[model samples]
Target: MLPGTLRAALAALVPLVALAVVPPAAAAPAPEPVAPSAAPVAPAAPVTWTMQPSSAEGPDGRVSLRHVLDPGASVADHVTVANLGEAPATFLVHVGDGTVSPAGDFDVLPVDEGPRDGGAWVTLGDVEGAERLGPGSLRVSVPAASAVTVPLTIAVPADARPGDHPAGVVAELVDAGPSRVRFAARVGVRVHLRVAGEVTARLVADDVRARWQPSWNPFSPGTVRVTYALVNSGDVRLGARGTVSASGPFGAGATHRDADRREVLPGGSAQEVVDLPAWPLLRTGVRVHVAPTVVGEDAVDARLEATAVEVTAWTPPWSQLALLALVAALLVAVRALRRRAARRVQARIDAAVVAATTPPARPAPPASSPPAPRPSSPPAAPRPDVVPRVTEP
Candidate 1:
């Protein structure tokens, strides 16, 4: 029999030896799960606002402000500005001198610059916290999703020139926060104030020129580019439509192209260019015709005259001429060669005829023959009977 303590120790060693001999079954590592890529987030939408001509009551159905008043006359009008954003915004309301841009769009002077013409004659009504920026300029604040109606007055100067003094009332949105790059959005309505006076509708064409672009292919026609400036020297704003025509000398190969209609403010000029297909005539004549018409819905009572300008361009057919010259030179060379060949043939024929007609010298006799003595001229004649008797003897 074993002791109790020794038996218990043996039992513990047996379990430890079994555990060391055979460890727990090893587990295989699981694959790492892949996470999906995050989707791109869209940027927030920008805020927007609007402005238009209005009345004290509300926004009337007017697209722009138009008035025909005498010099020194004053007119009252209104403009409405609406804030469409969720937050309240401050706006700078000002009047600016209106002018037609080079792109033919109506534009106003910058807010920083002061207006001198019709814009200078305008004044804004007093509002709380309304700070005067300059002549005819003020700053006002509007509540979120609300509209502000502002009163304005246009008092034309006594010595203002007769004709159209174009201007506009602009509302520029103030930026909410400070930024490295500053940008302000602006909206406006045009103010067309025509001072009552003698109105003239005239358009002048200046610096008219034409250039010819020759084609590389000898058989195809070239293009003629015509350029000119259309000046509105009259008191009224005018639109014009013109035609560009090109023709060769003596009015041959005439081609006509129509120019698109364009509007020009008083004292403003627009540069126009047109291209037309033209034959490569030695000399080409280009004509530009500009006819003046009323701009927009204005009913002007004046004669709108048409202006025409003509210019000449040299469009030489260099490729065709070169090809023709090459052909001519080839023909000349062939003709020269033919003439030389004919001469050679003629020379050969002449030599053959001379050889055939020329008599050969008589060949020398093979043997020399003895010559008989010459008889006197008197003994030459003999009767027939005597000659026979002598022969018989």
Candidate 2:
């Protein structure tokens, strides 16, 4: 036998060890993540159980579990649990409200958190407490290789909101050893409950934002990361559909991407991110349209019941735009420089041409031309008269 101190220390480490192996959640976690596969069981554990929707032929062959009920309405259902181990085993049964993880995986309320939604509406014939399974959780024993059918009832309150309320009925295996480790291997089926009357399937896009990551090469394409929150403003669980479109001003270079499909619970919200390869145009108008879709059997009238919400975001490709502006400025500066240089060159050419085409100033005429032979003829006549007088003298 182990010493008292050793036993105490082992007991203290039990919960921590259990938590270390299990996936983390917002609340108290199970020893392992509940597997959704048909034969979900704890790894390396001897015990195995199968939980499936009730069936007339057998519980193993049912397709899915769902119910559409009016306010204050109640429905009877059965869940089949089987023990596939070699020896007899005891299992705990739990029913809890459902939620979706940030990673878009479906989950149930933690063991510490009681059900406030459809999980609270579930009642088991063998279980004492209806909500969170505690000390009052029902335990059932089955012989080796044997299966038992457990009957359960779900009631929708008169004031139950119309739409989808997801829940789960889990069959868990607990360790009863001295260490008291809280290891539970769970297997169960989903419960999709819809409270009838005016099921509003609507989603709203909120806080839509876009960020552009420009490529270093201004001529190449960049990335556009768009993010938005899908809020289930109506009273049902839904998946979002539609497209996110980005277009430059005046509808140039329009680009669009499809939104991924993810479940959102009624009154709950989820964030979606989409990355698109795009050319970095100067101004881009971003628009997101999310239409709500009702999944499961409750969606008979979904076509007419669904509604859509839209949001818009405008972003400027500053990096690419700045680069373009810089190029334009450089081009203008170069053009101005070329023009100035051409004007200087042309002025020099014009001066050279004029000098070559101009005539030199004529040599100045003799500053005073000799007085022309003023009276050559008159001198001759005078000479004739003067000669006659000299002869007479």
Candidate 3:
């Protein structure tokens, strides 16, 4: 609600009502202004609004009319709240995404959810988070008379379809203190998002290299590593029912090569080089089957070429330059990652040592430690007169 308009509105109501009640005198001639026989007309009644705080402002509090949302646009409002009450009348509320409620709580829509799901379902405690927002929902409580500007925002995941969808922002007034207030007003936010029709993916591996590590080493032989890595590079995150199967050189064997696997997601992938029982690497000409996460997605018919794979010893003459280059790169990468891990572990150890060696803090002084009572000498002499005579008797 906006200001200044209310004052002008009250002013305009008077003239309009006066003109309606007083009509032009009928053609009857005035007969010496005789005493009126009818009762006087009463003024019009005042207009009553529910939460008529002395002041309120927020672009008049209305949603946008457009039906399109941008890639990462916020579906929130910049609300400016001020104290209109003589004392202080604060505006406190919480905001959330989903279907709007008549009483004003919010819930999520299925389409807004991610392929991977899990986030907090929250009822705002104090309206502090409102100072910041963008992720999920927000709840706010304001102090009276003092003005606060809160920006309400909405988020659209990049994967959302480009078409129109139904979504809204719901905000509610909550009890800020122990005033025992009953009900609070609510505000609604409308949003339309326009998501682009594109998703992106790339081969994340660097220059490919392969070599043979000692048999006891946990890693796959270099030849197997590079080949498997590329095949796994495409996508790893996919619907549960997806499948990726291959036969040819690589690790595919007579019975094993036919092993079926789940499909990967658009841009997620993983890789591995495993041990083989015989020289029968899944060679070229072997067939592969791919079932996409979605029925119509491009991954449904993934027919990849299976190239021949062979391992060589890492020692000088047997180890080819190609294999040596790969080994060198792997060694550098391993060293870097190990250093990073070592630093993290050392920091954690330092923290633990400091915690163990530090002494506990002493407590505050006791309030009742006071002056001690001293033993005093007994009365030196008894009452002289009566006491002495009684003793003798």
Candidate 4:
């Protein structure tokens, strides 16, 4: 099963819906319906309703209920219901307190739950009887193709809170089925009632925050996500409208994003998020605003209030830093290459300088062979030959 609030919101958007209230001077006797209710067990009869502001009370066919009254005051109005079926059909007329749904929609209290606040002050009666009827509810039966008008009286209590208090008066078809499961249709109109007083309107900003998403490319810009909450602290509801802005250093790259308008209930807040393109600067300024638009109140008399919040952020200059690092690395590499080349050139030059400046090494003298001992040997051979000759002589 859906939650109670969700169910009530869905009910408020039902197709069988209309709203209107008759002016004070328009009060008059509504025409007789001339209808009656049939047995409860009879076949389910198809029915439709046509509601309008009674001509005797005000204009013809006004579709919404609206009024502005001071405390301890009251007003008279009328709502007409038409039955299109061929048989008599019964309806239970009731009213409920109104509220703004989370989705920024108008809704009323559930049919099963009775009014607890200002809605309880309203009373109803049958036009023909001219007597106070049920508490937040009344029963009426209309014949086929005929209509009935019910008078509405809203009395403001002496202690009623000032501001807009929306309510609804509905005509619900009574289900008379045998099973526990019952189906019924209801048609109604919204009541825009304001308890007159000194009304104050205020909107506030809270928890303003921003997140940066850096782009992969160093030269390209990145994105900033700005988020904030708008609070309605006044006694009435309001619509929030404004913009979020982010700027880089020196305000060079600025981005403005429009906020989505949403209804905020009294004492309630709505969170808004916006994505903005931002530059790769070191510092950033982020601002969020809540500009209140008076809603469900008398705009002519009510004042519009606004609030804004600003925050400072630091964005890292990774791209620039990376570039500087690369340049430093290249300089280091070039210096190393130059030093290596200089060393090689210096080695070759040193060799050539020595060759041109220094003398060649001198060659050492060769060793002499032993002197010949031939003189003594030749002398002995000659003496032997000479000795032989002398002996013979």
| lDDT of every model, 2 decimals | 0.87, 0.75, 0.39, 0.77
Model 4: per-residue Cα lDDT over 11-127, one tens digit each:
986644443343347568999997888658865567777555554443356667788899999998877777888887877778898767756677777778878775787787655
lDDT of 1 at 149: 87
* TM-score of every prediction relative to native: 0.73, 0.63, 0.24, 0.59
Whole-structure CA lDDT of model 4: 0.77
- Alpha-carbon shift of residue 229 in model 2 (angstroms): 1.5
> Which candidate, 1 or 2, has the higher TM-score?
1
Across 37-80, the per-residue lDDT of candidate 1 in tens digits comes to 89988654465788889999778989999999998899999999
Supply the TM-score for candidate 3. Answer: 0.24
| RMSD in Å for all candidates | 18.4, 24.3, 38.2, 26.5
Ten-residue stretch with the least lDDT total in model 2: 127-136
Q: How do the residues 219-337 of candidate 2 rate in per-residue lDDT, one tens digit apiece?
A: 67777788888887777777877688887768777888988567888889898898766676666777787766655455635443333333344445666678989999999999999
Best-to-worst TM-score order: 1, 2, 4, 3
Instruction: List the candidate 3 regions with Cα displacement exceeding 4 Å.
Output: 1-67, 70-77, 87-92, 100-147, 176-185, 194-393
Question: TM-score of model 1 relative to the true fold?
Answer: 0.73
Which candidate ranks first by TM-score, i.e. highest? 1
How large an RMSD does model 1 have? Answer: 18.4
What lDDT, from 0 to 1, does candidate 1 have? 0.87
Runs of candidate 2 with Cα error greater than 4 angstroms are 1-45, 55-60, 127-136, 177-184, 300-393
lDDT of 3 by residue, 95-146 (tens): 3333323222334333224212211212222234353233444434444445
For model 1, where is the 10-residue window of minimal lDDT?
384-393
